[model samples]
Target chain A: MAANSRFAVAAHVLSLLHIHEGGRITSEYIAGSVNTNPVVVRRIMGMLNKAGLVQTSPGVAGATLARPIDEITLLDVYRAVQPEDGSLFAIHDNPNPDCRVGRNIQVTLDTAFTRAQQAMERELAGMTMEEVCLDIVNRP
Target chain B: MAANSRFAVAAHVLSLLHIHEGGRITSEYIAGSVNTNPVVVRRIMGMLNKAGLVQTSPGVAGATLARPIDEITLLDVYRAVQPEDGSLFAIHDNPNPDCRVGRNIQVTLDTAFTRAQQAMERELAGMTMEEVCLDIVNRP
Candidate 1:
């Protein structure tokens, strides 16, 4: 429930771009599709623009992927929108360090999360945004 | 920085059990080791015990795994502690369902998350908790 908004936002934005690949689509239109405020879309666009995943224009303009959708994996979009985290999971801090187990709880968690995320990324790396979009298009 | 605490607690508790195997341990001690309240340990213990991952008792009691440490994969621990997920990645709610992508993002995201999580579990299944513990015990 608490994963984060960036991944979702990135997906939404990419889907919007896929729908309007040739024509420049305004953030307002994208936000309308996402049901979120245009300002939020714009903010995320600014970050993606900085990350070079997207090319943006000023005033009533929209953004599009700097590269082809076929070349972008979910991991590419994820990394562009979300910072690289070693593990997909995070450890709860303030563990009882006084106890031996507490002292190593974070350590153990780090290992598990890191391994799990690496596994997830390896799988995700196999698919491109085109594949995702194609799947959506072909869906019944 | 955003990860769940469930696995953290489970792994810590399990590691402690392995460290002090053959000896009964109490939730209070486990909680102390996890740096959480005894109540928290007790709650987790209830589930772990049900999953046959651990055993527990009343007063002057602690918990231990039902089987040897080598038999428990991280996947076993994860399944034991996974909480109810309201949404996979917290995609925008109230999205314009009339929009094609909006109508489909949820479905697509859920599928992707499922696949990603499966890949993660497969990876976790490859290693035992013993490997994790040894890494720690042997850590310099």
Candidate 2:
């Protein structure tokens, strides 16, 4: 799950929180909604909370989006789950730099990945959980 | 892996093809550029070719971007590799559809995913393979 899917999970949780629209919800309930383990839900919440997207409380408490659902973008959720590892699309480790193409491929891939991620972020930037909530309401 | 990195691999390959600038390179070479196995490279290439993002040759052959890399965006590469399976984010399969929150989460997720992917494409629309290649040449 280290591959950046928490965005999906985070969005799901946030949508639920938005639906609740008032108070915190337990990880157990959220996990039930997700059909995943409570630990999984809590872990995702932890990540989201660390990124300032959500706030968590212990004991008789659960989690809530730090801001309005519409204020949160997919990118915000993504940043919360990203491991300290590196870029979203870093090149392979220790490429065969001996080869002419391999030697320089990193540079090219970096630029491409950068552009791709920028594109992704830009795309994500245009949206908020509010739009998603609207669609959910409109769904047949 | 059926995870996020797969897209990174596809983007890496397409970015390399764009850098090749229409030069015919074998899958082995593409894999080499990606630092992954050639078989895996060929497999992904086969998918890309099928998606019309690339053209491949049979028997000891390589692949080339079907569209100019500039005309292509990160979304194009992602589509070629993954075929837009389901949603961009994974939600629980057995959500409590009975509950208002669980019932509508999928629709919300879909809308969010669509907007996010579109924003990513629009941002990517600002770049071209030529810029990616030039960045490679200029990188320290």
Candidate 3:
């Protein structure tokens, strides 16, 4: 499977929103910054809205952060945009039951994968949209 | 993109090798246990070999661990199978530089992502093939 870029794209979207807070920026504009399509932005926006990270009003042309930029962590955005349970690792569902490794692979992998995911989330939780926006404005 | 299954697949290969050490196990057999293709298994094996985690010899139908399972960490398997610098997260190459957020996004993302990758590796480094194999055999 190809690597999913949703996390990067979603973080990009949030940073843009943080930089342009109080302004009505369309998904097309966000897509332009993200170098992707408005449809993709909208799909991600829909997920973000559902997760309450961002909100879209019926009359609004674009979305806005539901809370302050500093209040939203990358982990929040990650969870918002991620599909399913959003586990970064996946164990093959069916393995040869007769093989000892195959029979126990899922449980063993799941334990390790769960820990890796939590570790990743901890790292992400330390970063916020405000921090990203600040880094952009301060970049050399 | 779908989540990559290389970690689980590689670990599965390692465990099977551990359980049947000194015996030749074909890629076909490993694929059967993984429920993936022999080509997929071979591809992973190639990476493992390059990492010096596994050894392949002439006339041998299968590969074996280069080190004891207790000495091989999940981090080793992960590094073996990952492409490029093996960073778990990737920032898109082209973000709209005209936008403040876009201009600095990559650097900002790289910093966060690098930390996330380190955290994940730390978690993986704590586990070993021996532990995984034990989990398998102990399962009801």
What TM-score fits each model? 0.86, 0.72, 0.90
lDDT for each residue of candidate 2 in A82-130, tens digit (9 for 90 to 100): 6755365445655556555556656666666676567667777777778
**Candidate lDDT (C-alpha), each:** 0.76, 0.69, 0.85
User: What are the per-model numbers of colliding residue pairs?
Assistant: 5, 3, 0
Better of 2 and 3 by TM-score: 3
Which residue ranges in model 1 land beyond 4 Å of their true spot? Answer: A1-5, A83-86, A92-108, B1-3, B86-88
What value of lDDT does candidate 3 attain over all alpha carbons? 0.85
Task: Please report the TM-score between candidate 1 and the true structure.
Answer: 0.86
Per-residue lDDT for B6-79 in model 1, tens only?
77777777888888887877777777677778788788877788888987766647566798889999888878
lDDT by residue (B1-140, candidate 2, tens digit) is 32345565676677667666657777777777667798888888888888888887787454766876667765566566665553445555667776666788766776666766665556556665556555555654
Identify the candidate with maximal DockQ: 3
Fnat, 2 decimals, each candidate: 0.68, 0.48, 0.84
Candidate with top TM-score is 3
Candidate 2, what DockQ? 0.38
lDDT of 1 by residue, A37-98 (tens): 88988888887788788888787485768988888888777677775543555566787666
